[model samples]
Structures are given as C-alpha cells and as structure tokens.
Target: MNNFFPAVLRLIAKLVILAIAVIAVAVIVFWTPGKPADELAERWATPPSLFMDLHGMQVHIRDEGPRNDPEPVILLHGTSASLHTWEGWAEHLAQHRRVIRMDLPGFGLTGPHPREDYHITAYSEFVIALADSLQIDKFVLAGNSLGGRIAWTTAAVAPERVTRLILVDPSGGYPLPPKSMPLAFHVAQLPVLGQLMDYMLPRFMVRNSLENVYANPDLVTDELVDLYYDMARREGNRQALRQRFQQDDNGHEQAIIRSLEQPTLILWGAQDRLIPVANGYEYARDVRNSELVVFPDLGHIPQEEDPDQSLQPVLNFLGLAEQR
Candidate 1:
C-alpha cells in the first residue's frame, strides 16, 4: 500500500495542474466580446416594443386585449425563442382575452439582466412581476418547452395568479432532447467556443437551424430570418444564453407538476423533433385533469409553423372558441 501512495499523489498533482490550465483558458475565452452582425443593426435598431421594470431590469413583452377583458393570459416561449412563438396565438387571443407574452431573460429583445439567474424560480418571479406591472391578478398560463417548465413552477409557487395551465411540449417529466433542434442550443452550451461561433455567425448556420425546427424548412422566410439573426446579435443576448444554460434547479418541478390539479392543456406536435411527444404523455399522466392534444406531421414548433391548426385547440382549451 505504501509503495502505491507516492504514485497516487503524483497523479493527483498532475490532474490539478491540468484542471487549472483548462479553467484559465476558459476564463480568457469567456471574457472576450463578440462582434455584432452588421445587417443585424438594420433590423434591431429599435428598443424592444414593450419594456416593464422587473427585478432591476427592463423586461420585453407583448400585451394585447380589449379594455374590459377580465381574464389575463400569459404566454411563455421555449429555450432560444422569444415572444414571437406566440404571435399567432396572441393575435387571435388578444381579440377576446387579455394576452401577454414576453421574452424570458437571456432571449429576444429583453436579453439578460445585471443578475444572470435563469432557474425556473427566477423566471417564475419575473413572470409574476411582469403580471403585476400589467395589473394582472388571475390569468391562464401557457408555456412551451423550457417555458412550460417555468409556467408550472410559477403556478405551484403562486397558485393564485395562475388559474389554468397550458403546456405545449413542456419539458420536465422526461429527459430526452427532441430530434429536431435549434442551432443556438448546441452553440450556447460551450464555455468559450459559443462566443467564438457567435462572432462567426454564418448566415447559413442560422438558415440551417431554422430549417431544422420546422417540418417544412421552406417556411423560413427572408424577413423572419432577419428577425432571429438581428435579435441574436444584440450585445448581451449570446452571453445571457450562456449564463442561463449554466443555471440549475434541483428537479423539484417534476413532483410539482404531478401534483398539479389545475384545468390543464397539454399540446404537442406528434412529430415534434425537440422535446419529443412522449413528454406530453408523461405530464398528462401526472396531472389529474390534463388533456393532451397532439398534432401529426408537425415538428418542434407547432404554434409557429401550424398556427391555424394549433390555435383552434388552444382556443378550445381556454373556452374562448365560441367568444372569438
């Protein structure tokens, strides 16, 4: 035993030195700033359309509804997505009920804050704070993927504010990444490699990512591509995404969703490439009153790609089908 002790100590010292070198390199790479895309400036020239003071930062949101509408509805988008995910639903829902959608911190126009916490609880607090700023007390909550996880967490923490729950391909009960994925996701996970990739922001990379998300890649238009590219180039967004990916919540959301008893709607693209369709059933079985709606032949983003079919089910779930 004594003969081997010296060798073990030497190995430990070598490992420590290697770890320090790796960390030092990471720090240097992380500190360097990325050059913003040129055409991006033309597109994102304006400040966000809606900015509400929340947790010491300006939150960007889109609010729509008639003046007298009573039930306020909030929409949360998935990872790497902004309020645009709810564009079709918001446009239709705003007619009857007050609809509010925001870019969760680290995404879209709002980007990141001074504090870089992106855990579900942190996001939940921001959701409530946004609702407070808009004077919304009770509302239906709908979220997709990561957004779905945040919505459920908010309802579990503050049940009074969330009366109904809608989870479109929500992620928590399962542990599989959807087959169809966005490029931003992989790039954001690397410590400094992501920053370097962002600086190289190849237009083809953006197009390929958009192509992968939809069942029909042709759906990606020039103007819409510009929106995503421009917003991605905004100074703090890439860094914010990196910080958010590092945030962790100790799997408490699974138990909370299983105990959920709200009038819940679970919508999924049967062919969802990201987050998969099985996740829909996992939550359906957990939530006693949840209904699962699956759309065949669609990819990850059912709301954005197939709004006509997607909005109908969401409207029915909210009981706004007849009103609109």
Candidate 2:
C-alpha cells in the first residue's frame, strides 16, 4: 500500500508539470508586444484624422462637419477606448454640427502623456488645452465612462467653455463598486498581473473586455477586436493605462460633479454591470440642470452599443431633433 501511494504521488506531480508546460507554451505562442503608434495610425488614422501638436503630443483628432458651426460637439471616449467609439454618432452629428473627437492621451494613436499624469485633473486640463489649440471658445462636451468624468470636471473647472454636458455612464458621480468588472480591469489592478500586461497582452483579453462592456456580445466583431487590441498595444499605452488606474479616484470629486452648471444630459445603460443605473439616478439628483435617460437593452456603452437609439435623446437635448 505504501508503494502504491508513492507511485500515485509521482503520477500527480508529473501531471501538474505537464499542465504548467502547456500553459507556458500557450503564453509564448500568444505573446503580444506593443506596437508603435505610427504603425497603428496607418490603419486607424484616415482623412479626417489630423495629428496636431497639442501640448507637446501629436494628438490624433478628427475635426469634421461645418467649421463655421458656432458651438461644435467634442466627443471623448472611455478608458482604453479611442475616439472611434463615437464614429456612428459623429458621422450623423457632423452633418449638422461641427463634431470633434480625439484619441485621449494614453489611448489610441495619441499614445501616452509625456508626464505620465493620468489624474482626472490632468485630463480636464488637456481638454481645455485642446480647445485653446483649436481656437474654440465654447462648445458642447460629451464623454463616456472615464471620458465622462473628465467632461464634467472640465465643465466644473472651466464652466464658461462648456455650453452643454452629455455624460454616458460616467464614473465620477458616486463611489459605487461595479457588480461585475472586466477581466482586463481586474488584472490592471493586480500588482503582478498588471506589470505583466505591460509586456505581454493576449488578443482574447481585449476581446473579452469589449464583450463585457457591450449589452450584445455578438456585436463584438473581429474587426472591433482588432481596433481595441491594436490600440491597447500602442507604445507606452499599456503603461499609461496602469498609471491611470493607479491614479484613479473612484468619484472622490462628487462635489465637482454636483457643482456642474451647464445643461446636462445623463445617459446610462440599464444592463450596465460596471457602473449601475443607480449612479445615473444620483447624477440626475445632484446636477440641478440635468436630464437622465436609461437604455434598458444596453450595457456600459449605450452610445456605442446603440448609437441611433442613444443619439435621439442627445439630438432632442441639442434642439436638433426637429432637423432630424
């Protein structure tokens, strides 16, 4: 009996070693290195894409529609997302209003901030600086998720510059934890895994993150995966993401949000597991001049998930519904 037990232990040890080997092989095979922003820009940056020198960074921006429009719309994207998230809305909105979207520093073709400062304040300042560079005095500011937080912060700090605010599932209203966080975000919070992410990222990780945010997983196409994966792998972006997450304050600036004076439009995805619909209610309650709209069928990104449906409320708010 003693001999049999020893043999079984040996077999178990061998099986464990084999499993480890398999995992190591998979890791090596799928090892993804970061790509230079120039390489990614070829596929992502098209005609409207302008690489302007803003605050010492070659900011990748798309300025469309009639430049004569007095009040243009500036669209900002969420964490790990580029301006492309606003493509559907921007395309339609550009027909009437001047529409501008950019890859915020630490994401997309814009790459990372030279200072590596990813605080909400830094982002707010960047928005103001971008406006100055564009020579735009005042406009409607709209953002989603992290971008939404920046949008409101900018309005609070520079109230005169923002005529209207559209916050979609913004993260700065309440200090509520997500019911279900994306695997990538979870890893980014871990010391070890987050560091490893800087060097090696798997395609599945990007795909899973996108699927997690969308109400419909099927909408996450291979092309969509390619865009996200490519942007995530941009040089210095992964590290910037890590820095941003580290510096993130989960709604410590509720005072700033409550202080917003611009006419605000709050949009939330009812199916959002990241930031619940309750936060949306809090925004409507806190912001004196705000309207809240919840999309029952959408998740974290209602604008991206259903731009047509989500844009209707925004159009009405902008008084462009009659034009439609």
Candidate 2: 10-residue stretch with minimal lDDT: 249-258
Which tens-of-lDDT digit does each residue in 35-126 have in candidate 2? 98888888999888999898779999999999999989999999999999999899899999999999999999999999898998999999
- Once fitted onto the true fold, the runs of candidate 2 whose alpha carbons sit more than 4 angstroms away are 1-26
Q: Give me the runs in candidate 1 sitting further than 4 Å from their true place.
A: 1-48, 250-252
- lDDT string for model 1 (74-129, tens) is 89998777888788888788888888888788877677766778877789888888
TM-score of each: 0.83, 0.93
Global lDDT of each candidate: 0.77, 0.91
Candidate 1 backbone clash number: 5
Candidate 2 TM-score, true structure as reference = 0.93
* Best model number under TM-score: 2
What C-alpha lDDT does candidate 2 achieve relative to the native structure? Answer: 0.91
